[model samples]
Target: MSTDVEINLLDNRWDASVASGMSESELLLYRSNVLGSDKRVTNYGGGNTSAKVLEIDPLTGEATEVLWVKGSGGDIGSIKMDGFATLYMDKLQALKSLYRGVEFEDEMVGYLPHCTFKLNPRAASIDTPLHAYVPRKHVDHVHADAIIAIAASKNSKDLTQEIFGDKIGWLPWKKPGYELGLWLDKFCRENPDADGVVLESHGLFTWADDAKACYDMTINVINQATEWLAQKSEGVAVFGGAKHESLDVDARRAVAASLMPAIRGFVGGNQHMVGHFNDSDAVLEFVNSQNMEPLAALGTSCPDHFLRTKIRPLVVDFDPAKGNLDEVMEGLPAQIATYRDDYAAYYERCKHDNSPALRDPNAVVYLVPGVGMITFAKDKATARIGGEFYVNAINVMRGASAVSEYVGLPEQEAFDIEYWLLEEAKLQRMPKPKSLAGRVALVTGGAGGIGTATAIKYLSEGACVMLVDINADGLATTVEALAAQFGGDVVRSVEMNVTDEGAVAAAMAETSVEFGGLDILVSNAGIASSAPVEETSLALWSKNLDILSTGYFLVSREAFKLMRVQDMGGAIVFVASKNGLAASPNASAYCTAKASEIHLARCLALEGAEGGIRVNVVNPDAVLRGSKIWEGEWLDQRAGTYGTDKEGLEEMYRQRSMLKRSVLPEDIAEAAFFLASDLSAKSTGNIINVDAGNKEAFTR
Candidate 1:
């Protein structure tokens, strides 16, 4: 079962070049962002970041002195500038040396005479000294899933030596912060040349002169551990061999939900859950194991993981052979009570000089026999984070031991960090997503043909869209075509001119903001202008550009800017004519501008992709509908100029295309919405043609 080949870690040395003039916070933040990409070193909250500030931003004129460490609560993956806390070096140093006391919460808060939390906005992380103690300029820490899996094994300590020979250093899992730092300081001093260090039942740490170097070292350590685990647990057992006939998934989730408060109280929100209980004779047998004391031995892999995954998995003893739901539910409360009591006792024993009592835990995962794992979150994201951590932890533990014995960091220590006030406060200031639910979007050119049909399609999907046109009378009539199909909010109408930027921007911003941020923006505003090239005048050219080309750009640019900073990305569609693709006579400026409009969409597509924003252009053949281009005055005048009746002129436009039928707006919106949804996560930078196979398919 072992992999064919394993990679050996080559990085262990610290290079001076890696410590270039970056702020300690910047370097550490940089490290966390890069390291989070690795699967083994961390999962969600499996790691932390830090840095010492050598200088202050002079322009802000704020105190030039401070050290900002990763806040008490945050994911290492997207840790931001505000994610780090600022503290006065003097106060932190003093607190580190504090002894037994009455737990002066104010003393800890006030200790930073030079650092003010509220005034600075960024508070410092509690484990500040752990970073300060490292003589190296940068430090990277992680709950290396592989290393911990191996380290936690009774055989791992010796196995690590067996596998790596001399490069790996093992530290018995110690409570992190000062004690761990002191122990680490001594070890580093002893083995100045060791390549990497693994914490027993904890994670791994690798630091180098640069971000890539540190990242590469973490990957190397993991690949080695992965190979080792595969060798050891080649044919280990998995959960769910026996079925719990009576218990369903929901019943298990319900029982866990009832008991979650005890586990959740330690962490704030987003708990990892796993339902490992089985109707299987194995789980029942294990629950009844003379050696298996689920409560006493179910500690987690590391203390840092406490925020997402509580100290233990809820190991249910549902009998596959027998036992009803009521019986299992009846005993769950007692187990929950035990978890709470253990948490409280842990706080009393491990709390240092002056931290406040713990808040209830945030999230705890359960291991109910038969039912699968279920996680709880303030929202779905955190729940998944916590749940994934526990599931991974269980996998590693199972691999680490021939029969792994649970040994997590002390409850008191886990609670100290999990309840750290400095951590909770940092997670508060982020923009939540706003993807318009139960709201309507009103597009002016809804049905004539292209715009109107497009609007109809948007209505088909969930949006309440108000379709509009210069021919308000026609739009009202199409309501009958689309009426009784969905609720009234699905579509609406308004008469407006795209040439009026103020009115357009105001109308657009108002309608969508009033509804919510606009989810889909299709600026298919235009007019089809045609005249003999020699006779075209300044007046005609100006009107065409103002209404057609310039109008679409103005609307699209505004939509782009709105979607860019809206915090969540959105989709945009432009309805360019086939004329925009090729060229038509007497229409010099119209062709030039339409071509320019296509370029505008292409540029916005490039810039907005960074924000998950998508820009798409749809080209359609001539459509005789609500579009002013295909409407009365101009079309008749152009037809007269062409020496043909309106019927003949219409046929002239349709017959030119392969699909003889005119393209409708609904057809355009269908293509637009596809690019807007989850279907197009990888479909950016492309133009979609709802045209009836008119142009040769040349892709950009």
Candidate 2:
């Protein structure tokens, strides 16, 4: 194995000019970013980095050595200087004396805060002491997959010693605490030539006097381990079986569509939940391996991953040939019951007096043979995180299996970290989630102004959104933008002409499968038509009716069917227009179609009331600016009707409303959000005017 250090990134965009005169803290931030940018080094929030620096006390004017370590809940990839917690080394070292005879679960947590040099609100990482005790100027710690692949193997100590010789020290599995720090301090003192330490079933720790040296050391150590595994596993197929074959996407989706809802209901407790499907090649290979059941029974690759993916994932049998969705659904309750029973039993065996309340017995990742993986959480972002961590776990497990056998931390040790008070406190300190945290929403006409705005609003308020539009290109752009703001898993795109009954049905089925089930539907897709009744052709009239009126009915019918199947009450909001309630010249087709849409909402409201579904309408007027409906010939014709230009028509409408504010796509979106959320639980068959203040279109 070559130990040469090279920084040949595919995209080496880091500016040396910008980094030349950086402060010690800024250099630390840059180094951490470099480490975090590599997924092979660490997953999200899975590692910590620190630098020992001299800081003059503001009050005393005395220089003291301090450790600035990555704080709790901070992502190293984009972290700023404030993301680190400053801790006094003297105080931290003194803590060892105080915690000498103290139990790790009881006494170590309270002393962590006292070691803080500055009274910052951010809590220091639980591994802060480990960083402080290292006798080096710079320290870098990561749950690198290559290192863990070796550390988590059945013959970890032997494999590690053979790979790195005495260049690295080894510690048996120990939860991160004062004892682990003391052990590391002792190991480094004894093995003065060791450049790093590998924690069995945990992670890697590398240190040097300078930041680059430490980082290079990490890369070198990981590369050696990876090279050894590569040589050992040459021509050895990791996954092989007759059962492993190409998966049927449609059949898997059908199975997911049928089984996810039941799983959602069982795991959701009182709150609703959403599920995301992951069929990446890595996930599929792991799920399809003949040894999948045995491999999955092994715990998570590391203890840090326990909070995202539970100790072990739940595995369910699935066969596309049998197409026995009902059988799978029938067996889910018992399977989940057994999972819960096993979890509770594990807790009973491992619980300490200081252990926090047992978390809800829910599986984070689900593995199905011949199908893909499904991850469930209270919201989309968390579900994506769980899915991502499981993918990483599979890679690590595969590497370890290729060498020898994959073995994770023992149950008791994992429990110690999962129920650790320090980790639990981080979650407790987070702000309360948004009202629509676990809800799912579908917005049609999503490529247009109103649809895109409504999707953004729902996402901001913490709802997973499905953007449906007939324009494939436009829909892809919109979904990409929203996914950037919210996470990609929280926002998705579906292409369908809402007027086609078959397309609408398939879209609804896909949405249900994608997000477990639906809760809110925004029927906002429509186009504008401007002509006098004498000038309007049959084709134009029929086209407007098919999309504006009939399309709303088709989408609502399909959405309502899924809502009823889930037995979960949902909301539907129809985007009509001010012309629907009032008369408008030269817009006979558009006005007529919108009016029909309004009455159709009312009829559905009456029928949906029995099923606890709320249906309402929002009438917006003259929202010309981002709207494609008022562009091109339609803009000129509407302006000509008022004997002025388009700008003049906009000003006249803005001045006509009581509020004198221009109605926008976001304005209609706000009204739609209110109707879709629980704020309007008792509201149905209602028309909210989003036209600034159009008294002429007001409803009694």
Index of the highest-TM-score prediction: 2
- Residue pairs with colliding backbones in model 2 are none
Q: Which stretches in model 1 have alpha-carbon errors above 4 Å?
A: 1-30, 50-69, 85-120, 154-160, 236-297, 316-363, 377-380, 403-406, 410-700
Q: Which RMSD does model 2 reach against the true structure?
A: 3.7
TM-score of candidate 2 versus the correct structure, residues matched by position? 0.91
State each model's CA lDDT, in order.
0.58, 0.84
The lowest-lDDT stretch of 10 consecutive residues in candidate 2 is 1-10
Count of backbone clashes, every candidate in sequence: 54, 0
Per-residue lDDT of 1-700 in model 2, one digit per residue for the tens?
Answer: 1212222222333556767888777878998998888877778888899999999977689999989999878888878888999988888888877775536434675777887776866788768878888999898888888789888999899988999999987899887877788888998899888999899988999999887678788878877777777777666566443255535788778777766766776787768899888877778777877777888898886876777898999997676456556788778889989999999999999999978988988788898776788889988777877888888788778779878889977888888778878777877988898988899999999999999899989999999999999889999999989988887778888899988999998888788678988899999888888998999999999999999999999999988888876767889999999999988999999999999999999999999999889999999999987787887888998998888897798998888788998998998989999999889999999999888877778897
* Deviation (Å) of 573 in candidate 2: 0.7
Candidate 1 positional error at 105, Å: 13
User: Where does model 2 exceed 4 Å of error?
Assistant: 1-21, 100-106, 118-120, 237-242, 248-262, 472-477, 480-484, 487-489, 509-514, 655-661, 692-698
lDDT of 1 by residue, 95-168 (tens): 65662333433234344434544456654444555654554545567776667777667655677787776676
Error of 1 at 255 (Å): 11
Task: Identify the candidate with maximal lDDT.
Answer: 2
